[model samples]
Target: MEQAESLALPALLAARAARNGDAVLFSDRKASWSGAQALEIAARRAGALAAHGVRRGDRVALLCTNRSEFMEIVLGCGWLGAVVVPINTASRGMQLEHILRNSGARLMVAETHLVGAVHAIDAQTHALESIWLIESGEGGETHNRSGAAAAGASVAGTPAAGAPAMREIAVWPLPPLGEPLAAPCIGDGDALAILYTSGTSGLSKGVICPHAQFYWWARLTAGHLGVVPGDVLYTCLPLFHTNALNAFFQALVSDAQLVADRRFSASGFFASLIETRATVTYVLGAMVPILLGRCASAQEQAHRVRIALAPGVPGHFQQEFTERSGIALLDGYGSTETNFVLGGGVADQRAGYMGKLVPGFDARVVDDNDREVPDGEAGELILRADTPFAFANGYFGMPEKTVEAWRNLWFHTGDRVVREASGYYRFVDRLKDAIRRRGENISSYEVEQVLLSHPAVETAAVYAVKSEFAEDEVMAALVLREGAALDALALIRYCEPRLPYFAVPRYLDFVADLPRTENGKIQKYKLRETGITTTAWDLETSGYRLRRT
Candidate 1:
């Protein structure tokens, strides 16, 4: 199947399905879609979306978990040339509302369980034109017309259509499998999707990814990761993120069967891998220690997994992990803003290095002035690919922010690192106050601001410290107000309901004073160096757990 004329994702999938109609394309517990079956579902979904007034360039928000519907919508949106906005299912009412409003989503497809959360924001958001609930049952409660129509009414003594009525649209079944749809008139510059960054770094910004960007990234990833057609690639990462989506696309491009999990579970990981006979899988450094800490069994080493693609693995644990698990751990470095700048495939395995830069991309270690630093000198990592089509279009709705990242003709990755003479890059730390935990980015400034909201908290500084397992873990250093004696449990309780789980500081260090620079800025580097000191209270270990609070 030639991709020259049909470079769009939908067209590519369609062409592939036509070539391999009966091949198993995707397998999940809820459903298994063959190549032809998936293509038909995508076509029908495209028709349904188009019938609902979704057109080219229109933003359609998908707030569903990892399931068959998610894949169908992703492929279908490509056919209609509409930009898909994949919302994080973990986001609360306010976060969801911000994304919907910022994206100016004309349509929102939410799951049955999330209907309540969607309705909570329905009254406040004016941009949403329609809300379609997935998996609605026959005897399900009907949409409240009063509540739905009331959204159009003004709360400020004026009338404004806040959101359209939550309607139970008919489920469109998959159309008869046919030859792949002919190539649509699309270009490398067309906006394909907007993946919002995890709000760990302040408010999340929607990263604009085009069809060409995804296609090239997928190609490079397949080459770098050594993905093959017969390989059964298993993915548990949320599809909303670039890593998961890239994994899925790379598998598809290689004609490999994808074994998907609704959500990642440390306990069920090995079982799923063995059951699916997964030959390859992607993981974050945080997951590595968690898996290793779990009760080791013969079955863990018995799995057919040949490669574990991990990022940000600590230098010391690399050898121990490989020896214990009998599976090679291939570590690489990249971010949502830029895809696959450097990686080591199955063939290249260095102990501590994050492999050499891949073809089509240029990498350099630069100092504070953006000038190239000598080899082995630590500096900010900046990457540029010759193919502009491979890079992200820009951050959606934020021109200044987009320009800031893509300035000087190089995509500035806010990571600090050093490159060795062997071309392998070593990650030092982040220049931006962003923390990477469990493959998720968390902003130190954002968490600090949230912690400071407590009445007893005079000031707070958040930073990443080395966890016992291997990767960085969130740790907070806080100073209580004068005459106030708030303990760690109270502060943990306060943050439990306010922030996402990853953003919640795992270790709390209560201090009388916080280290700061002369300019009055908190010196997170110094705090990180000090590590976890305050053992006055261990909240996470104190059995103070809340179920989805």
Candidate 2:
């Protein structure tokens, strides 16, 4: 499949299915799809979407959890030349509304458990005319427990003629298999997905990824993992993010099967791995430590997994996990815009060093003016791909952001790194004031926006405080309204439903006021430097527990 990178998703699937029709392709608790079966399902779904008036270039947003059906719908959209917008399951309130409006999605496919979150979306913000609710369980809110089916369901305030239609479909429903439709017009450059990523500007920006982006993402990462036919690529990471999508690409391109689970559970991870007999997977950020903290399970050693594409593992933990599990932890560095741009083979991988730049891209550490920094000096890492559309096309609906990011002919990563004389690059810090908690990128601006929405809050400055393990813990310094009587716990409870679990501030301080610059902008550097004072409200100690769905 040398021309695989140039083939659109539909063409890629056809090629694979023809060569290995009966091969097992995708799996979940519900069922497994074969190579031929996957293509048939995708085609029927494409037909279903067409019947729903989803046409070329139309955007279909998916808010379902980690299930094979998500991939099925994505592939269907790909075949129809429709853009697939994956919404973060953790997002609710304004965050959910923003993505739908920003992407201008005509239809949404969300699971039953997520109906409450969808209820929070502002119906007036966009021209969304339809919602295809997928039943998650027998007793979910949107599920019709009376064993009923319907053509469509009426939504409140929807126009009788043109307003969005809301309909419920079964969880992981399989449309009738039929002849796959041909989309000769859909090419590699056609838009495939709009992955929402946190920006330095607080509000999340949707990164437009073309079909070619995912194709190469799979081929390259699959090569790095040494994937072969019959290999089982496993990932419990949510499909909303690029990491798992890349893993999905690996399976599609390399003729490997994919075992996608519902979500990551640190306690049951090893057991899951053993059950899947996975050969390769991904472990990001604190997951490595969390897995290590578990009691030594026989299942850990029983799994056939050989390598884990750990992008952000600390050096000491990398060594310990490798030694203990007898599985190699390969470290690399990348972001949503660009897939992995740097890495090393397991034979030569270095702890904390992000290895040499991957082929098909040019990378440099540069100063503010875009001048290349001297080796061994800390500076912003910028990358330019040799192949066209290898990185994200740009930020959706934000040409200014796209232009600003691609300035000076390089995709500015806003990450601090040091290129040593030995030619290995080590991550230093995030130049942008973003926080990485667990594996999620928390925009300080977004978090602060939520905090400011509270009635008692007057001024809020949210910043990242270094976590004891690694990455960051979100901290907020707030100045309450005059005579306002509110506690940190109360404000947090207020933000519980409004913000994602990861975005909620773990440490809160109600200061007299915030430090500002002459331009009247809050100086977050000063707040971060203030560190955690004794008065800071510790959410963990305050008995606040977050339920991760």
Residue 80's lDDT within candidate 2 is 87
lDDT string for model 2 (292-374, tens) is 88778677788899999998888989888887787898888778898778885787688889888887779999999999999
Q: Model 2 Cα displacement at 534 (Å)?
A: 1.5
With a 3 Å backbone cut-off (N, CA, C), the pairs that clash in candidate 2 are 129-164, 129-165, 130-164
| lDDT to native, each model | 0.73, 0.82
Model 1 scores a C-alpha lDDT of 0.73
After TM-score superposition, the amount by which residue 476's alpha carbon in candidate 2 deviates from its true location, in angstroms, is 0.5
Worst 10 residues of 1 by lDDT: 149-158
